[model samples]
Target: MENIWEVSPLHRQVKSEGEMTDLYKIEIRDLARAFCGALFLALPLHYTMEMWARARAIPSFMLVVILVAAYLLNVGYCYYSNFKGRPARQVPWLDALESLGVGIVASTITLLLIDQVNAHMSFDVIMSCIALESVPTSFGASLAKSQLSAGNKEDDLTDGWATDKKKILACLLGGLMFAFNVGATAEPIVIATSINYGQLIGIVVFSLLVSYLMVFMTAFEKEKEDEGAVMGPQWAETLICYSVSLLASAALLFMFGYLTPTTPHNLAIPWVVVLGYATTLGGSAGRLII
Candidate 1:
């Protein structure tokens, strides 16, 4: 009788091809998710006047530093966040490079769409702008799997709505709840323009502390079980979610015309911080409940 443990050469070859095909599908899905995450998190910076202004002024060396820093951050995040539950072998450095490439491509395409990159701008300026924007986009790409994954039954509702769809709807509704009128009004701008540098910094620190407290530290809707499934440690998760809130705040404000190309960085940064406080609370709460 033929040995059950032994495989025929043709069978082995077919199995190898099947594995290769599965890996390709996983990689493609990962890339598509990365692109969506990059746009979701980094779109706000595309509208920030400060970002564009700083692009022209940023030193070439600093631009290089930003690129390297983004790659290193990607490596660390991708190590844990990419290819989850997949049979493929993990190569974090290679994944990091892929994330970085996605970031660069996403940034370039968005900048072009916004008319931010034109022939009149020097090549150095264009490159610097893209490099600066690429940092957040690459970070977003690296964190995509963790942040954008479909919700598990434990974390999602039992209703007929799909868990992933529910998760996304919850995020949008939560953000809109806090940011809608706030973005439409002049309060954020007034507060931003009125605050001194010290106060602005204090707002940022306070926002971070409050957001962390609301989502992670509090007993409100805390899920003790499956804590291991959550992405990153407490502090890191807090930081990432807070960053998302800030991005959301910026995008909302820009959409409302409160932050425009003519708006000064001095005001824009503070406006984002001020409005981000509310959005952060909503975002953290939204994710916590979901």
Candidate 2:
């Protein structure tokens, strides 16, 4: 008693193959996005001398820890952000692994291209360099889910509901991204050393004004509504974020060995202010983007 309208096994097989093809295409597209994000944020680090030096000096155990931390970060980020541009899997380990792999691959290629690694280098050194570089790359790849998307909206209806804590975190992440480049370079120290107290004051004032304008003035009119204002008004938000950016700048500089107990506050404060300029802009932009 088979129905005349029954589908054939051949048709079901064709449908399955088509679905597989579509999934494959989605994977390829996500891979490209991950690669782009990795390079966009981490390329400057690849060129910085400090990163290379750190690679050689940091303990091998620490290098492995850094890589594992990056992978775990990717897992949490991908779970929340849908880095694949689709519903996240029940477990996001695959997405995290892919993100980590993209970072490692990008690091390897760029280090090789820049002559930071070669046959003459020891195996341990080479691995350490790649591992260290991949941390930022992997983080950037995770961020691509939210920041690099083409369909980000500007309407208040879409973003006005974000909590103050989320905004602050975004600012920190953004500040880190911008400061990462300058923190590792010698230019910030040089600028800090050359500038006078008056110039430093001017830089600090300018940084605050720029951060305010970037987050408030730059947004469209429709994007100003705030339904989640338990943390006070926009001005307070800007001040807090600006302060966070400065703190983050100092921390990053310390991590890069630019700040030490022997370094006088006279020099360290200016160094922070110099880098804070970039971090403030980044924090503001991050607030807007998120």
lDDT of 2 at 119: 99
| Residue 146 in model 2: lDDT | 66
On the 0 to 100 scale, the lDDT of residue 234 in model 1 is 65
Using TM-score as the measure, the top candidate is: 2
Candidate 1, residues 1-290: lDDT per residue as tens digits? 33212333322322233463344454466689889887776778788776677667667886776578568756755544552323233456777888889989999999999999989888998998888777767867765665687623332212455433333334443554446445645678888888899998888888789877876678985464333334456676667667777877887676544677788887788999999888877766666553
Off by over 4 Å in 1: 1-21, 83-88, 151-193, 196-212, 215-290
lDDT by residue (tens digit), candidate 2, 226-247: 6356557767877788899999
TM-score of each: 0.54, 0.78
- Scanning candidate 1 in windows of ten residues, the lowest lDDT window is 3-12
What local lDDT score does residue 7 receive in model 1, on the 0 to 100 scale?
A: 30
